[model samples]
Target: MNAKPLKIGVIGCAGIAERRMLPALVADPDVEVTAIASRDGAKARQFTQRFGGDPVAGYDRLLERSDVDAVYVPLPPLLHAEWIERALRAGKHVLSEKPLAANGKDAAELVALAEDRNLTLLESFMFLTHSQHAYVCEQVVQGVIGELRTLTAEFAFPAKSADDMRYNPDTGGGALTDIGVYPIRTALMYLGSDIEVIGSWLHVDAARQVDVGGAALLGAPDGVTAHLTFGMEHAYRSQYALWGSSGRISVRWAYTPPPTHSAVIRIERQSHVEEVTLPPEDQFANVVRAFIARVRCGVPSGLEGESLLIQADLVDRVRARALIRPAR
Candidate 1:
């Protein structure tokens, strides 16, 4: 609490911003929301009215302010690289929504730029900061799951509105980048980045020319493996599990649990099955605090830069190796 509060501005009032992100930023004592920008003046005004920040009609104007030391970008994936680079060049730290960019190239460039300028660049993988994940890791390490053999994850939801940007290819809309990264990043977390992509597949939405569903297989050196399935055209399933020799540990609502929702772990062994429920946590708020703490440390470049690069590279590799299947 001794460190000065970081003054931050937002680049867009996207739904994720309203529902999960902005609320957390506004509540954090170490973060000051200087402005909230939107292309629509009225929408910007509405967010400002609720969040107590200045209403900015344009994204660029918010970047020019002296009071702003950081920026939070909740824009589409295609726009991430552009604005992130601009914010860094403007001498402002950046926290962008997951995926970082549509490709690894842009992600690498942005990470290097942040390092060169000694700025904080974070990808908002809020779930990773939640206490539930750490607890899960602890359980795994404590031999509750025995010798880890496999990790599997599923993160998907039903179709969006007819006009949702996710159905459009131009916005970097696809199951892989939009939802698949949750499991892929989690895979890297447990399996390590050195894991190789064994096989993959992407089901393309014929009319939209974008991927709607897919799965990938990844293998690690120590006989551990990961199986990931993600989609935008399926029944809602946000969960992952770790299977060891003697038992398995699984989680429900793993990726996007509501703040009031408690963490639940389902464990299965040869003898019995049990459930372990932990306290509720708002991952969105926890991630914002982690970002604030990283900034306060005054480190030139944090682990986030490396995380972004590997995560993006893994995404690229999955796409390159995936077998194309038509949603006919």
Candidate 2:
């Protein structure tokens, strides 16, 4: 017998929810988006009209729905832990957007709540669900890259809009919390969560009162090192490289590749180069499937909670250590 589709509700009608997440959820056979809610009822109604879900007046109303088996929280970082806690208390499984919380303490608290309730609470690190990353991990583990020595990643884009939430410090907005977390998490995925931040620098837009860009150097006691650079205002760049003793692996379009874009992983060793091109994948859909599998089929989330805590802690340390300079 086939398992039933998981009924889902969305807590916010953010751009990500409308552009990327809704389409991915709608395309998945294992999910049924039962409801959508936004602070603006009209926006919620419009989202439902386009996305195929019941329109709820507010988030609390959506949480009160008996038919909503799970909720996807796409709120900003500052609001993630609050609504995630509310959704869990309302007896709904949750898949929250990344940076799970503003800091490590809040993230740990939410994880504990989810554990206490036995609900599947997943942080939406959609890129990690993509096959390209899996292939890279497998190749590295099997010594295709030999013993790992260093990792370098950069994710940045120009966000010149003053109204963009990423420029608002009160909203947990900064390069470290926004784009920086990607490289930090990717480093942890390969180098383990025991890494420490040894050196850091940040550029802050004093007028905007937020971090626009920064670089961090992380080192594991075992000698593995990761260099991460991220920003919200800069030339477009999203990629990472893994440098090992024998060979090196590089991934292009590492973080935000579209569902239909082919991913290329380049391997170089001994004056020879090989390229592994992976077919398009809907990572958001994969995340939904994984969430359902864990919630309904009793599959585990595989140490994501611990990794989230580590990521949050490292973000805190980086922010604390970095020398902030006013952006010109």
Candidate 3:
């Protein structure tokens, strides 16, 4: 028999879903959007109409639905943990956006709940779903960058606005939490465990108290140093380069650039250079499909407490070290 359609609800009908998730999901043939919620009732209704889905004013209404097998929690950073826990308690799987939680403690709690309930709680690091990242990791393991010595990645996009979610301290706004997490997590994804934040610095707007941009130095267990930089006050820039004893590999437009959009992966060996074009794909769809598969086949979710804990731990440590906190 064919599997039932994966009934899904979306929270936070704001930026990321409207721009990225909605379009990607609507284009997906495997999933169904059952409901949507937003703090603004009118906006929620309007967004539901726009996206061709059911509309509810509050997220609680969506959570109450027995048809919603899974929920996509795209709320601001501070809101992730609470809603995720709620979704788990409601017996719904969750595909949450990055940073996992407002802090490590909350993230640990969410992980524990997901574990106790045997629920699928995934952090939506959609870029990691792209094949380019895996390809890069393969090259690294193959010694394309022999004895990986260094990693440098940067993500910078112009500030959307002071009122934008990225600048709202109450919503967990900061360059580190926003874009810096990408490079930092990317490093951890490839290098394995024993990652430590050696040192860090932040440049903040005097009035807003939000970090406009920042940099971090990470040390791996094997004597590799990764330098990561993120800025929301500048022009668009996203790239990563891994350097080692024998060679270096670099990816331009690493994170936001679409996989099928004709990006080049350059591998520089001591003697020659090799550039390859990566396959294109909708990574968000991949994430959704995975969630649907797990929900349908009675299969286990790949996401686990240890992984979420690691991500949360790193993000929490970075925030603490940099001394960035939400405004009162």
- lDDT against the true structure, per candidate, is 0.89, 0.89, 0.80
Error of 2 at 85 (Å): 0.7
Q: Per TM-score, what order, best first?
A: 2, 1, 3
- Can you tell me which runs of candidate 1 are displaced by over 4 Å? 298-303
> Over the stretch 1-328, how does candidate 1's per-residue lDDT look in tens digits?
3877889999998999999999999899888999998999999999999997899989999999999999999998778888999999999999999778899998999989998998889989888877777788888899987999999999999988877878789986688989999999889888887989999999999889899999999999998999999998899999999999999999888999999998998999999999989999898888787788778875422238787798899999999999999965
TM-score against truth, every candidate = 0.96, 0.96, 0.93
Worst 10 residues of 1 by lDDT: 298-307
Model 3: CA > 4 A from native: 297-304, 323-328
Local lDDT at 209 for model 2: 85
lDDT (tens digit, per residue) of candidate 3 on 1-328:
6666677899888688988888777776777888898878888888888787788889999899987888998898878888988899999988898878867788889888987887778888877777788888899888777888889988889878657877778886777787888887777876675788888777787677678788888888888888888878778989999998999999997888753586689999988999998777778777777666666664544344677788778877776677443322
Residues 16-94 of candidate 2 have per-residue lDDT tens digits of 8888998989888889999999999999999999989899988999999999999999987788888999999999999
**Superposition TM-score, candidate 1 onto the true structure:** 0.96
lDDT of 1 at 93: 91
Models, CA RMSD each: 1.7, 1.3, 2.6
